[model samples]
Target: MTYKANLTQYLSNEFKRLYEEPFNTDVTVQVGEEGHSKIFQAH
Candidate 1:
């Protein structure tokens, strides 16, 4: 499977594991260049 597809599956499984239910909410992942972690905002 593709990276995004795998990520989506992982997110769903994780959400379910935590909440004991399926993940129905939308997800958005923003990637950046190396050393750009500082630019991303914390959720």
Candidate 2:
């Protein structure tokens, strides 16, 4: 698999793991290069 594919899979798994647990607030995940990052929110 390519780097992009691996990264996507990694982030997907992280999100799944986070969501699988009980939480009372929003969750944010950071994904991107060293100098730049994007945030993804899940509740």
Candidate 3:
């Protein structure tokens, strides 16, 4: 209902999707072009 609540929901859903990937597979975190890609961890 509130701005914070909406953002929280979106982040939670994203976390679930990323977590559901194969346990051993690295979750790629792309931000820009292929030369400027970035990988990050949830924690």
Candidate 4:
């Protein structure tokens, strides 16, 4: 897999983990140089 693919996969997993508590966590998947990142901010 390419670097971006790997990063995307990693970010996807992070989203799953963060989204576990959908009511509490504001999980956002954003595109970046690497591929993606999960941003979590308390609401």
Q: Per-residue CA lDDT of candidate 1, range 4-28, in tens?
A: 9999999999876764422222321
- Name every residue pair that clashes in candidate 3: none
If both were scored by TM-score, which would come out higher, candidate 1 or candidate 4?
1
Q: Give the lowest summed-lDDT range of ten residues in model 4.
A: 33-42
The lDDT values for all models are 0.51, 0.53, 0.56, 0.55
Candidate RMSDs in order: 11.5, 9.3, 6.5, 10.6
User: What's the C-alpha lDDT at position 27 in model 2?
Assistant: 31
Candidate 2: deviation at residue 7, Å? 0.3
Estimate, for each residue in 1-43, the C-alpha lDDT of model 4 and write its tens digit.
9999999999999987765455343334332423224333333
Please identify which of the two predictions, 1 or 4, would achieve the higher lDDT against the true structure.
4
Query: For candidate 3, lDDT tens digit of each residue in 5-35?
Result: 9999999999877654533254344334453
Reference-based lDDT, residue 10, model 4: 99
Worst 10 residues of 3 by lDDT: 34-43
Question: Would you give me the overall lDDT of model 4?
Answer: 0.55
- TM-score, structure 4 vs. true: 0.45
lDDT of 2 at 35: 28
> What residue pairs clash in candidate 4, if any at all?
none
